[model samples]
Target: MNHLKKCLASLALSLGLAVSSAAAQEAQKIKMGVMQWETIAMTSSVTEHLLERHGFEVEEVEFQEWGVAFAALGKGDVDVLISHPDYAAADYWERNARKLEKLSVASYGYNAGLIVPSYVTINSIDELNEHKEKFRGRIIGVEPGSGMMRQSENVVNEYGLEYEIIEGSGPVAVAELKSALDRGEWIVSMYWTPSWVFQEFDIKFLKDPKGVQEPTETYVWLAHKGFAVQNPKAREVIASVFVPESALTQMTGWVKEGASIDEAVARWEKANANRLDRQAMIGNQ
Candidate 1:
C-alpha cells in the first residue's frame, strides 16, 4: 500500500509538470497583422509557420491598409508585424515611438527606385517631359499614401512636367502597367525592387537627376512592447527571420503567379530549410 501511494503521487506530479510546460508554450505563441502588399507577404507567413512548428501558435490578421496595421500594433491589438522602413513616412517607427516599443532586426537590404517597362522609349526624367504627351501626360502611382507616390509628386514638382498623378491600389497599379505594356503603349510611373514584377519583366530605372528620393529603403519586423516579456522564445525566432534579395524576388514571383500566401511561404520553406538556422544570425536589414 505504501509503494502504491508513492507511485501515484509521482505520476500526478509528472502530469502537472507536463501541463504547465504546455501552457507556457501556448502563452508564447504570437498573433500577427499582415499587409496584403509587399514581399514580406510570403516571408512573414513562412516565418510564422516555422515558429508554429517550434511550438508557437500564429494568428494572422489582414489589414486593408498599412496605416491600419501600424495602428493595430501600437494599440497592442496584434503581436507581430512585418514593417517597411521607407514606406509612407516612417509609419511603423512613428507608431512604435508612440507606444509599441519592441522591434526586431530588419529582414532585407534594398532600396526603392522609379522604373519603366523596357519598352519605354524615354531613358531619363528630363526626357519624359519632352515626350509626355506620348504617354497621355499621366504618371502612374500606387496607393495614395505610399512613399513612392510622394517621391513621384516631388519628381513632377521639381521637373515642372505637365503630368497628372493617377491614384490606385498597388495590385491595380501593377496590372495597369502590364495592360499598357501588352498594347505597346508608353507609360512612366513609380516602381520598387524585391518584387515579382522585376523578376518576370524586363524594366528600366528612369534617371532621377533631382534626387527626390535620396536613399534606398530597408524592411523590418516589429512587435508590441510586452512581446519580449510574454514570449522570449518567439522573440528570438522572429528576430532571426530574413532572406537575401534573390530569394525575396523569387517569393514575389511566386505570389504574382496567384499562389496563396501560405503556398508561397511553403515553397520558400522547403527550398531553404538549411538557411533557417542562418537566418537567426543574419544582421543588417
Candidate 2:
C-alpha cells in the first residue's frame, strides 16, 4: 500500500511538470498575420527569421482581407503584422486603432498614386482628364477593397474626372499595364513604389497637386494592444529591424524576376550579415 501511494504521487508530479513545460513553450511562440502582398510577405519572413534566431517560434496566419487581418490582431488571434498605417491601411487602422499598437517603422518613403509610362505626355492628375480619350476613359486599378483602390476612387471624385476605375487584382492590373505599354498605348493606372513594376518599366507616378493621395508613406510593424508587455524581447527585435526603401525595392525586383520569398530573404540576410548579427543579439544581454 505504501509503495502504490508513492508511485501515484510521482506520476502526478511528472504530469504537472510536463504541463508547465508545454505552457512555457507556448508563451514563447508568436503568431504573425501575413497578407498576400509581396512586401508584407518579405518583411514577415525577415521578422520570422530574426525572432527564430533569438529562440522564439513564429507561426504565420494568412489573411485575405485587410479588415479581417486588423480584426484578428485586435482579438489577439495574431500577435504582429507589417502594415502601412499612414496610407495604404488608413481605413483599417482607424477602425482598429484602439486595439493595436505600432511597434516600429519597417520602411519609409512608400508612395502610391496614378502612374503612366514615360512616353505619356501627361505629368499630373489634373492632366489625366486632358488625355481621357487617349487613356480610353478608364483608370486601371487593383483589388476592389485595397486601400489604393479606395484612394483611387477618392482621386476620381476629388478631381471630378470623367473616367471609370476598373477594379481587378494586382496581378491583373500589372498584366494590363504591361500589355498597354507593349502596344505603346497611353495607360494610367493606380500603383505604388517599392513595386517590381518600377524595375521592369520606365514609369512615373502622376503628380498629385490636389493632394488627394499621400505622396510619401511609411510601413510600420504593428501588434496587439498588450503584445509589447507580454513579449518585450520579441518587440525589441522587431523594433531593431528597418529596411530602407531602396533595399526593399531591390529585393522586390528580385522576387519579380523569379526568386521565391525565402530566396529573396536569404539574399537580403547575406547582404546584411553584420547588421543582422547585431540585431539578433538585441535582447540577449
Candidate 3:
C-alpha cells in the first residue's frame, strides 16, 4: 500500500511538470494573422523575423477575410495582425475592438481611391464625370465585397458621378490598368497605395474633395487583449516595428519582379540594419 501511494504521488508530480513545461513553451510562441495581400504578408514577415530574432517562435495564421482575421485576433486565435484599422478594416475593428488591443502603426500613407496614370489630365474624382468619355464611364474595381469597393459605391453615390464600377479581382484591375497604360488609353481604377503598382507604374490617386473615401490611413498592429500582459517583450518588439510606405512599396515591387516575399523582406532588413537594431534595443529594454 505504501509503495502504491508513493508511485501515484510520483505520477502526479510528473504530470504537473509536463503541464507547466507545455505552458512555458506556449508562452514563447506567438501566432500572427496574415492576409493574402502582399503588403500584409511583407509586414508580417518582417515582424515574424524580428520576433524570432528576439527568441520568440512565430506562427503565421493565414486569413482571407478582414472580418475573419479581426475575429481570430479577438478570440485569441492569433496574437497579432497588421491591418488598416482606421479605414479598410474599420468595421471589423469596431466589431472586435473590445477583445483586441491596438499596438502600433505598422506603416503609413495607406490610401485607396480612384487612380489614374500620371499622364491622364484629370486630377480629381469630381472631374471624372467631365471626362466620362475618356474613362469610358467605368471605374475598374476589385472584388465586390471589399471595403474599397463598398467605399467606391459610396463615392459614386456621394459624388453623383455617372460611372459604373466594374467589379473584379485585384489582379484583374491591375491587368486592366496595365493594359490601358500600355495602349495610352485614359482609365480610372479603384486602387490603393503601398502596392507594387505604385512602384512599377506612374499612377496617381484622383483627389477626393468631398472625402467620401479615406484619403490616407496607417496600417496598425493589433493584438488579442492581454497579449501585452502575457508577452511584454514580444509586445515591445512588435510596437517598435514601423515600416515606412516607401520601403513597403519597394519590397512589394521586388516581390512583383520575381522575388519571394521573404527575399524582398530580407533585402530590406539587410539594407536597414540600423533601424532593425534600434527596434531590437527597444524590445530588449
Most TM-score-accurate candidate: 3
- Per-residue lDDT tens digits for candidate 3, residues 183-280, read 99999998888888988889998888898998688888899998876676787888888888899899988988899988999999999998898887
- lDDT tens per residue, model 2, 1-285: 999999999999999888676545445789999987777788788888999998888999998888899999999999999888877788899999999999998878788889999999889999877878999999999888777888899999999999999999878989999999999999989888888788889899998889999769888999989788667778888998887777778889888889988898899989999989988889889
TM-score winner, 1 or 2: 2
Give the worst 10-residue stretch by lDDT in candidate 1.
276-285
How high is each candidate's TM-score? Answer: 0.75, 0.83, 0.86
For model 1, the stretches where C-alpha displacement exceeds 4 angstroms are 1-26, 86-89, 109-113, 119-122, 133-136, 142-147, 167-185, 277-285
| Candidate 1 local lDDT, 1-285, one digit each (tens) | 999999999999999988677547546547788877656666677678668656667898988677788788878888888776455437557656656654565466455656778988778888887887788998888889676787788888888888999998677878888888888888877777777777777777887777776365566777777667556667777777666777778877887788876777778788887887465444212
Better of 1 and 3 by lDDT: 3
Question: What overall lDDT goes with each candidate model?
Answer: 0.73, 0.87, 0.87
Q: Count backbone overlaps in model 3.
A: 0
Looking at candidate 3, what is the lDDT of residue 191?
A: 81
- Find the 10 residues in a row with the least total lDDT in model 2: 19-28
Q: Show how many residue pairs clash in every candidate, following the order shown.
A: 1, 0, 0
Kindly provide the TM-score of model 1 when superposed on the true structure, using C-alpha atoms.
Answer: 0.75
